[model samples]
Target chain A: MTKPVLHLQPRVKTMISNATLEQASYEIMKKAAIDIPEDYLAGIKSVAAKESEQLSGFVIKTMINNYEAATEDRRPMCADTGLPRYYVKVGDHARFDGGFTGMERAMRSATARATIDVPLRPNRVHPLWRTDNNNNVGINSPEVEWSFEPDADWIDITTVHKGGLFGTDYRMLFPGDGIDGIKRFLLDTLISFGKRGLCCQPAIIGIGLGGSKDTCMQLGKQAACLRVVGNRNPDPKIAELEVELKDVANGIGMGPMGFVGSSMAVDLHIEVGHTHTGGMPISVHTFCLSSRRATARIHADDTIEYRTDPMWFTPYYRRETVIWENT
Target chain B: MLNKVNLDLPASPDDIAKLAIGSIVFLNGIVYTAREGVYNKVLVDGRELPDDLTSRSNVNFHCSPAASKNENGEFHIGGVTATASFRFSKYLAQWLDLTNTKIVIGKGGMPVNDYKNILAPRGAVYLTTVGYGTGALLGRGVQSVDAVHWLNELGIAQALWIFKVKNFGPFLVDSDLQGNSLFAQQGELINQNVEGLYDGLKEPALHRYGETGNRKDELM
Candidate 1:
């Protein structure tokens, strides 16, 4: 069967100049909001009892409190923004006034601006000195996972993924051969970190298997951005593995905040791609309780699209909020 | 009469480390607001803190969820999430001593070691509070943010304002001198013997001795 290409619309493409990028980031931070899915919340409530044998109510309330405080303060739910990544789908047939500056650049600009203006916590620092660049303007601020298709207008952007933290993502190291190695490594890395490393409760595991080294990581991040906090990968095999890992990792006894309980891990997602036989790579990224991603579909004529799933709803930012009505 | 205790927030790692094993203290009021990651970075970075933060608060670290106040004049704090103190305990003591600042209220107690012993003389203490109850603990009104600090390039975007709390916790004891950890000691004693179990191997003896040693005892 021939692979089918999806038509998409492209609009005016902006380079996202440093100033503009900075402004955009501030816009996202100050105004950017995420609508959490009810099902996701329900999942949290449901498994919460099983996860934490005791004080389940406390866990539920704490989770709610964390979300409430984050929303109220208008702060990035968690400090770690993970390896910044973006998966932008631009319609091939659609034409933007400025043309394409490549998805990576656009995302980088947005990330740079957000890092500074809205000033999402710059979790990206040197792996060595441990000094925080703080600007979110690291070697590579935001990674882009781009998929272009021929279409008329509109650019659909989804920032719904969770940030990937080292401790959480790199906990268990499962280094299987080829892609398997990467998969194993990601799992082992997460397990190694334990619950404390996992940080918050209701963690979502995003896995990218069978891709290039960098691609693997980006895929993992993109997977998170697309899925809700508590959903699983659609693939049966991957989903099963996710369930197995969930039980095994939780069994490690790294309960909430690594104290002692059953509720350490929550959701696990795995995204797989076919790679050359010899050099397959995989990466697993983790997002904590705070699922922080937003999406907007800007049409060629200036329209908007939003993603709504039972697990979450897109939050309306400042601009999206109606400021004034014209008679 | 309102008995209000006051303490200076911890400024240096030594300030954090020097907190004695057990001491009655009211962290007078100078400190920053931060949680584990921020705290970990601050200590590990070894970067000189902004002058104001260094001189102002006793210490700061991020606490999850939220901190709020209650109508009865108590703080309804939540998200007193447990942290891996074993990793930071020594680091904390060392910093407390250097800065001469003491006292931190969080969940769990500290490990017993030679370093913690120093706190005995320094009059430092590790205060324990209920974890998983963030709303209950932090209900006390927040006074103000002490300083603004950010790490990584993200700093350029927005400087996360670190706050200094007016009143943070009950300041209860989790660890004390003579190397006692209520959290650990209690668990250890329980696991070692089955004192609470009524239907143990000696149940038959107890049944035989029911009421008393004899019929009169049974009647009584």
Candidate 2:
């Protein structure tokens, strides 16, 4: 059977210079390393205000102080200024002056520049040979994932700082296991690796359910990167599951820093998708309390604007807010 | 059992033994920064301890600090990231036994049984530092960083650093010389709660996904 072809209108062409894009990438990386996003800042404040445990409160206060100090001193919020990971949305209408490879070169240069400018700790090392690149621009380092937006004329780039401390995990379950199996896997993961391990209590839990292993893992990454701490899935069932998981996770009494506390996780965000009848794959990714991210949009006219939130996995709605002036 | 105390480096075994699991301590004097590379070098490769390291009370840190050099070529430590302790437990235990190290400062829990059997018996304790407050902790507590060693081979991530500190903690005695571990206790409580929740659910029937399903089961 032949697939049906749909007629589509042509998109307006927009030429973006390599130099301009590279400069924008450098600025975004520098800011992300030094400053915690405003949304994350607000979440930390809210959690601190509600904290009842003495030790937990003290730790939260210190974290708040650390944020302020990092901003004022122009130093990294955490010592582990993690490996740079860019999630980019390139518009179909956008054309790079030097093509896709040109854009790749721009990103690589930007990463190397940010390493020294932000003075990010050189965390990249040869996996087997154990060689230090010093500037974090090694083999397959500065991971970038690309997606396309039809009919758009600008490119949107979101930089997520994934620290070395909080690690990622994935699991595959049979259809027979059902939601019960998911709950067990999630709870077990939290008990063993959450509060103390990487999720680091008061963490933002991102759960990806269904689909293939890779797809589920990507979904999990997106879920973990929700704009705000308490953002819920649009689907009611999944949203409710998030709330239940949050409550159950907090019930463990790990508290902030895994000491005694009432708040274990600030929020849980679950992203769901359809899977094959025989199998279900689940991936859990965590953003620690720091939850550092920054985003920027490059327009058709070569004007760049920094966004407060990337709003990944959703439609890009333009807001009136811009942090950096057009360059 | 939460007592606020100040402990001087090279502390006596009696002083360490008196510390309970919940005791909060402020560490004073010198602490050495040692990570996996340092462990591999000193313990695995059988390298001799530097005179400066052995002369001081062995209060080692499981951290790889972020530092930058000034125009004068002197390094200014901006912050410290505490690595997970479990990754280097065996080497840490061996190093402690060899050096009579009084304390090991790190984040995330280590092997409690091993610490109790090896570290505690050797007159040492495991201290837990604030994991996320790396910047604040370093900026406020650490007075100076000097006498760095092994930079040529390990780079910054695993180099040995000697830090002069003053009132450098709000550390919890997670594993004490009395053979008690705060992490072990918490793990027990967490395990009990999780197991109880799982116990009420009916077991799911077995099913397989993909050609590699059997391999996946073994891996999990």
Candidate 3:
């Protein structure tokens, strides 16, 4: 005996995509460029004189190089070959055609193809021995972080990148309350720690404020891709702090690659959390100049849309100015 | 202001094989890429490599050679970083010997004693970038991945090496002429500062009435 397949009016849809390794990653790199707004580029110039000159040629060249390489070779632009990370922004009206494990399988296919196609340097070695195992794949390789939003149409898929390379950002640990305690770590980070930690690129600073130690770090990395290029925190106190820190960072005399540039940090994005009665933990994760990321909208209609030009997504380059500040 | 300078440079694979043990390079040209995880699966299990891989000739690309572009328009290049391989510096030295790789880029000077001999024989060079500066260096437009060696079964963000490169940057010799690395100096300075402060604390003249321990010891 055989069971009959059910056929009815379609109320929802699902997409199980498997791109060649290189093809999938190339798509992600394209979207990262469009996500950064034109106004944000202008605003960065307004605050810092150096950005105007440096960003002019810098952003375009980066995008062209990033898009071309990623598309042509089907590999990631920077080699941190970051931890296999995924962001799923799902629509409420839609339902997965298959169960949880099935979705995992689809994403896994995408990641595997990216691994082979992108040819990212496998980052995970045994934590202890540090052996160079050849497989770029790992347990929980493509980490899927999901967010369900109330929306019609269908689910949207976007590639969110936080550079996986070492010293890609700054991490500040708060032991307890004291001016000296925080100052000491802050200064050290800006000095050798910042130099070594940031690897000497103009970076966006992700500040994890008032959270559990681990959450603080997560907030910093998660926020790394958020806070649109030229946007600011709504909180007044945080906004002021961002301004003050920018000034102090520029004062560090750490030029380009820590040699001597106008400002080592581009901007600081700070996120706060509830602290223990006695302690506070703060950290900073720096995103390198490449700032590689992109977004793709996989609609329910089987239409794959890219927000940025998948063929060429440029970084910030010198351009006309437009400022947008909302506090 | 953009300052441009061009110099014809020769990179000896042997020298780089030696120097890269404890140095980082600001690379920007077609360079090969590999990840530890992928190798572990394939080599250990006798897995099949992707088509046209060895013929692609990764060895010449891996070492410090002058810039070259693969068939793909993208340049194969990169600034050196803390490649997890620094921990396997010894094994990679042997790998480089087999591969004929001439240049390597990354941060954190590798341990000099580990593979100076391996590098010297090949005449390769190791280059270092400032740590935490991948963004700045990459932003400067050095290397972009060109062609890649694929182990497709592997997943996203896990490819072996997406080969590419463009501009090349500076790799300061943090190690001394004798191959002593500068990282130690920085690390030592930090250790000394903390140690000295601990030793320099003066005794608290007066003690708290409900003190759990002696004031002098706790304060110090």
Every candidate's lDDT: 0.46, 0.75, 0.45
Q: Which is the better candidate, 1 or 2, if ranked by TM-score?
A: 2
The Cα RMSD of model 1 versus the native structure comes to 16.0
Docking band of candidate 2: acceptable
- What are the candidates' individual DockQ scores? 0.05, 0.33, 0.09
For A1-327, candidate 2 gives per-residue lDDT tens digits of: 998998898865467888888988888887887787887777767877877777677667767777787788777777777777788888878876878878888888988877766777778889998898777788997888887776778888888877754547787777777778877777766755655545555677788888788889988877887456767776688789999987776776666666666666777888877778888888877788667788889998787999758766553221112632211
- Please give the lDDT score for candidate 2: 0.75
Sort by DockQ, top down from the best: 2, 3, 1
Please, what are the lDDT tens digits per residue for candidate 2 over residues B1-220?
A: 2578898887777778888876778888888988789888989898887776867857888887767666787776766667778788778667987777878888775877877787877888888876455554555567887588888788987888888888877777888776788877755655555557676554545433442456547333
| lDDT for A224 (candidate 2) | 81
True contacts kept of 3: 0.05
Report the Cα lDDT for candidate 3. Answer: 0.45
* Count of clashing pairs, candidate 3: 110
Candidate number with greatest DockQ: 2
Per-residue lDDT for A223 in model 3? 51
Residue A226 CA displacement from its true place in model 3, Å? 2.5
Across residues A181-300, which tens digit of lDDT does each residue of candidate 1 receive?
443454355544442333455566677765566656666755644666556665567778877766654554445444445565667666655555654555656555555555555555
What CAPRI class is candidate 3? incorrect
Please give, for residues B1-220, the per-residue lDDT of candidate 3 as tens digits: 3322221223333333344222333343444545454455554565665554444434222211112234674433322233433544644565555455554445544555543555434544444443322332443343444444443444322345544444544344344334444444444443443433324333332323333465446421
